[model samples]
Target: MIEDPQGTVLALFAAFCRVGGCFMLLPGFSSARLPMQIRLFLAVAISMAILPLLWDTIYPRAADPVASYVRLIVFETLTGAVIGLIARYFVLGLQFAGTVLTMMIGFNAPPSPDVIEDTAENQLTNLISFAALMVLFLLDFHHVILRALVESYTTMPLGAGFNPQGALITLADTLKQTFDIMLRLASPFIVYGLLFNIAVGLVNKLAPQIPIYFISLPFLICGGLFLVYFGISSMLEIFAAAFIPVFEGR
Candidate 1:
């Protein structure tokens, strides 16, 4: 019943190239804490699942001559990588914001093992980054990304080749939007840190004999923690709400 089984296999591999590339850099799935075997199998399984839907588009190209097929592989992988990087960069921006937030609040606690990755991160930074990622997962953000990937074949068709300039522009735009949103979320703390530090400095200047800076650490931490307790819920809400627009816009 099956004719051209070779082409089917080749087409499946082609699909795998793109999906695997995206999974290679996707946030939670790409974490070092996850086993490589799981990631590979997930990528392969998704590729197979998507292949039927994209069979017509991919099959013809799958039969390309060996040299052309190699080129296709490269282009498909790069295209998928560019798409994956767009999402990855946005999450990384939030992580960067978390780092900045921790520093601003004077919560320079010793770094601990990151919950999502193998890297060590400041506890507060880890908490913020992990929470934001968790919120995205809860909101089914991966579904959005996967949907975009499927729709992308229309915009970026198979064998169309990769456009480096376009990819760069897309990535740059993602960073700009991500930075704007994260900055808004962290601005209150930034202002708090500045005003608190300024007041502490003035008090220290007047009370020369007192170790005001050392004395002020507890107040600074307490105030920062207080702000975080009240503000984190709203911050995560805003972050989750913004993901759809940011991702689709880019």
Candidate 2:
């Protein structure tokens, strides 16, 4: 039989605070399309499963007074959020790259509902982001994240209050690295857009009556589509490969 139900419950709640906080911002799990209840249940389930492993570390801490417990809850939630955001920033970087790619390729199609967020996004950006996320799922990216979360106790033990300065620095570094990677991934399209538009501008200058801009639109769109078709495999490959290392803080 259970010797201390109250301690167990408190421990579970502490675990949930961190695990749930992480899931609240996790990429695929945190999608606006997912029902909040489902997310909550999943977080609870994962917490229950992992609690035994963290019992010694968490259960002792759970015995604190109510005020201290509340402070611990806040600190645990912040730690989880920081870890989750590290992964999330990379996905955002991919989305940003997709947006840049869409504009560079000259596809100005009307915005449509995003698969993850409530906001509207360009069709091509949506497609790329969805595809990339799907690929990461197929590769078991969430498993990697969960493993990291388990290991996080060593790095961020319970009772160590939240470190806003350290968290901000970590977030800032992740963003910088992610942005650099996104730019590199989108550079080819940038060059293509620049050179293609310059050539079109020269043609327009030479034949003012030709309506070259209108004439070039179809070609630009077609060329961009072709580039995407040929380059998408390589692009997603690089993205998926980079995800784990960046997420694990390697």
Candidate achieving the largest lDDT: 2
Residue pairs with backbone overlap in model 1? none
Residue 193, model 1: lDDT of 96
Count clashes in each candidate, considering only residues at least 3 apart in sequence or on different chains: 0, 0
User: What is the per-residue lDDT of model 1 for residues 1-250, given as tens digits with 9 covering 90 to 100?
Assistant: 7698888888998998989889888889899989999999999999988888888888887877654888899999998888788888888888888888888889998899998888899999888889999999999999998898888899998988899999999999999999999999899899999999999999988998999978999999899999999999998999889889989997
| TM-scores, each model vs. reference | 0.97, 0.97
Mind giving the per-residue lDDT tens digits that candidate 2 earns over 37-139?
Answer: 9999999999999999989998988866654887888999999998889989999999999999999889999999998899999999999999999999999
lDDT of 1 at 33: 89
